[model samples]
Target: MKKANVAINKDLCKKCAICVHFCPKEVFTIDQDGYPLISRLDKCTGCRLCFLRCPDFALEVETELDD
Candidate 1:
């Protein structure tokens, strides 16, 4: 299985932490600036749930190509 990546676009982010709460696997966390960070990358199931639930479309989750 491929490892998934969760990226947060700081420019568009509102620092709402919505993506942090929406993730059932706790894939995200609030940073010092209150923006979302990938807290548990290994826990991610590549479900893209955080991105889908983001209201500002600041977060993006995708399958990473194998190296």
Candidate 2:
């Protein structure tokens, strides 16, 4: 929980709700400008669904630590 698994690429993000809808954990929400906002990082099970579902590759999640 110390590190944020879901990283939003502001430049790559077109404010699309793809990541939002794709997340089963309800971890994402639409911002004022319709950008994908990671509302619940704690709820994230490190599921890569949001990352893979994102057509723009705007979101990424890391469940495990790197060796």
Candidate 3:
């Protein structure tokens, strides 16, 4: 198993749903304001889909091996 962490920069993010849509694990959801939120941090596989798909470069995903 692995542990993953996700970070989103609200400032850089233009409220685009790319990260939300790109995430395979459905780790993100949209807030009322349409901003991205971490819905399932534990479910993240650290595939970097959100990070890579983010045009604004607002998303960061890090993974660590579970010991």
Candidate 4:
């Protein structure tokens, strides 16, 4: 399976848990400040739903290439 990396931009994030709720893989969790955090990166399926649904463009999903 392909590996995925999740990136969150704190500056752009508005603490709206949209990414956390939209992710089918449940890869994100809300922090104390209400920011999204990568909680289960290993379960990520490289789906861009979180990235595309983000209102602030703060979340990103990147597929990692195997060497």
Candidate 5:
């Protein structure tokens, strides 16, 4: 399976929780600071929903093929 790296740009993020709500694999969670946390990276399917739905362009999902 391909592995995905999820990065959240804290500077750009507005704590909107859109990524947390839209992820099909439930890859994110709301942190204490109300920011989206990459909680389940292994569950990520690289579906790009979080990245595409982020209104602030704060989420980035990168997929790497496993050897």
Candidate 6:
């Protein structure tokens, strides 16, 4: 199965929680410091919902091919 590698740029992130709220698979969770955390990476569908929704352009989603 194809998987995704999600990267969050802390310097660009504004802690808007858009990615946290927009993730369909609940792959992200807001940490105590209000940063988005990839809590359920295995559940990520690579749909790019969070990446597209981030206002700060802080999120990146790259599909990983199985060998």
Sort order, TM-score high to low: 5, 3, 6, 4, 1, 2
Per-prediction count of colliding residue pairs? 0, 0, 0, 0, 0, 0
How would you encode candidate 1's per-residue C-alpha lDDT over 1-67 as one tens digit per residue? 6689878889999887878887888877788888887878998888887788788888777897555
Candidate with maximal TM-score: 5
Give one digit per residue, the lDDT tens place, for model 5 in 1-67. 8888999999999998989998899989999999998888889988888999999988888998886
Which pairs clash (backbone N, Cα, C closer than 3 Å) in model 1?
Answer: none
Clashes in model 5: which pairs? none
lDDT-better candidate, 1 vs 5: 5
Which of the two, 1 or 3, has more TM-score?
3
In terms of lDDT, model 3 sits at: 0.88
lDDT of 2: 0.78
TM per candidate comes to 0.84, 0.80, 0.92, 0.90, 0.93, 0.91
RMSD of 4: 1.4
Model 6 stretches astray by more than 4 angstroms: none
lDDT of 6: 0.91
Where is model 3 more than 4 Å wrong at Cα?
A: none
**Which residue pairs in candidate 3 collide?**
none
lDDT of 3 by residue, 1-67 (tens): 8788999998999997988887888988999999999988888888888888899989888899987
Q: Write the per-residue lDDT of candidate 2 for residues 1-67, one digit (tens) a residue.
A: 3344778989998876877887888988888888887788888877688888888877777677544
Residue 9 lDDT (model 2): 88
